[model samples]
Target: MNTTQELTLFDNESEVELFKHKITLEKIKNELINFGLTSNQSKVFIYLGKYGSKTASEIAKALQLPRTETYHLVNSLQNMGLVTAELSHPTKYTSLEMKKAIATLVKQEQQRIEYLAGKEESLSQMWNELPFFVVETDESKSEKMQLLHGLAAITNKIKEMVGSSTENIRVFGSMADVLRLYHSDVFDWIDNAPTELKMVISPMTKKPEFVSDLDQDKIRSLVSGSDKKCFVINDSKEILIFMRNANHPTRQTFAWWSDSETLVEMMSMLFDLSWEKGEMV
Candidate 1:
């Protein structure tokens, strides 16, 4: 039998096998650390795993860790379902099957994910209310008229204007555009009504009673003599105008939005005139 000075074990087949097992344990310990286990916990788990059942004091001596710390680590691992203890006099701790132990940790992570998913909507509402987010359209920034094209951008702009409207919301639009707003839940703000909504629908379009919760008196609509889709919010603070493009074979939509007081006033006056001419629905 022969061995190199630096090599701890290598004289024969049995010693080489023992060294291989030690190497395997070290690899497993590193893997456990990567799985979010503390260094001490990974070392203790590896020791218990390799040696099968062992007393806490023995494990501490083998790992050169303090007895008290080793005991605490064992208890944590046990609570995490990675280790189990025998009820005998000097309790012996043994690592659970590696596959089952990892499965338990994965299950815990999944549960946390589901919990966060359930709270996302409420958390998003709270985040929106937080003061840290800057308001994009400040009244003082008069030149900040935002041009919005496409149905989605225009719909969102309308929702934002309606959501922040304080005194009144006057709408002039085709029945289809109004229906799109209703289905998208933009009319949800009407639940907090008393902020009067005077609407005018295109004479060629059919009217629909959109939201059931809003006070019908607060939402008065009439048939418009002319056809155009536009809305003004809070006495000319903001305005969104939709331009119909019936020429598009695909029937695509487009719109313009602005918070400029000048633009809003012009749009508001037009909406008022449309409302006056419209026959009450």
Candidate 2:
């Protein structure tokens, strides 16, 4: 091969080697993170392991980290037994041997797990000892409404309603609303629940595959299109209604829950009328 061809071939080979190095470094960094090092700590540990002992200044300069931050990282790594410092005028940090470092991390994690396990029984006992009380008054007998924000709060409310329902449950919504419940694992709770369940979906929605696990007799599609409003009624007593668009992102989703006798009765009646108009799935 001519000189130009040789240089071109060498360049390609160097590029391939550089790519391989990057992948390897990334894998190492991820493993270190899993082993309990922060990203910066992993970077410092890997740099020390790869290039041998380095002063904090050298490390900070090479890694483009602040000098103070580099020292903190070195100190943290030393505390974790992943890095050590040489006793010299200017201390140099060195990484523990890869095998030994990993072993140390594993041992530390096992100890932590065992410690937590030992505390579990006592923690449970202490938790159980705490009494929960609600004082009853004239105001306590009045109907209540609660505004729930975000998907997490809404999901927990659904779980509570499903778990508490012993008689019947009714759901009405668009495809997007049904999909939100399905993705949130609410259907799993419903499927396992002993309570009777009746679901009504908008006419615009095709029957989803998740309904197959449910009793088809209990599933229905509305005779006419409806808006994206979604709600659940538990035992003709409590109700949770989505206050915002069900198709909105989880953070933007909002819901209102009520145990008002009048509101529940109205919603339950509406659900029954809609149910009557729905075609069986």
Candidate 3:
């Protein structure tokens, strides 16, 4: 009707019809499995779906497939119950009734879903049965000790060792060593601490007003923290020890996430006893 506009279909009903035609073609091209129906059979189904029933010769001419190939595809589709012969003068091939075809497809989908659910359950059981594993290292003590360093490095060690952990952790820091650097990133971490945090501040923090809310409220104070030779030990298997004081930013530290129950217990006992004598605020 709009022939005066050069017949470009993009902004009109012609474009909408074109897209709908493409979507229907894609849906009908069911290459469901290999070693199965040939392309001609698929096209015959689509042809029947679009143009209705047609004789073998008529289909061959419409699809441009060899007469012999069309015969083979029609025979295959007939066996699969997807195409049926209509008893007429020349005989016509028709795609199976749509309702029956859709029922078969739904059954196939249900079987596939059940198979996947069983597979996932089996995998979950296997994963749950796997034992915890540890990778071994032969690094020298000096090399291992040199790994921890700086504010970022040290705080990460604390988070890993104490975050969400139910056990008490030892954070031994020199009060003077952390005065200015206290609120930097370290206190931020302490504010959102996960588990119990037992601090061993150098006798410098005599008042509770100076520390973070988490530390001031939950912290158990005592002597012997990371300050003099700053170190944090959680249950023996995990230890974060400073190489030197905080005056210089370059002094590195060490973190040992070990599984030494004896070491953790001893350090925890010392902190517990000292905390008994310490005061909050």
Q: Each candidate's TM vs. the true structure?
A: 0.44, 0.56, 0.39
Tens-digit per-residue lDDT, 204-260, candidate 3: 546445665454655555543434545566644556556555645432433444444
Where does candidate 2 clash, by residue pair? none
TM-score of 2: 0.56
Write down the RMSD of candidate 3 (Cα, Å). Answer: 19.5
Rank candidates, lDDT, best first.
2, 1, 3
TM-score (C-alpha) between model 1 and the true structure: 0.44
The Cα error of candidate 2 at residue 81, in Å, is: 15
Model 2: how large is the Cα RMSD against the reference?
A: 9.3
The digit string of per-residue lDDT tens for model 1 on 1-281 reads 22231133222334444565666656676677756699889877766775689898878776678999988999999888899999887999999878988898888778888999999999999988887755767654555666666566676776677677777777665666566667766666654555667666665345465533555454445543444544546546777666652222112667666677787777777766766666545
Overall lDDT per candidate, in order of appearance: 0.67, 0.84, 0.60
Top TM-score prediction, candidate number:
2
Candidate 2 C-alpha lDDT tens digits along 50-99: 77898999888767789999999999999999999999869999999999
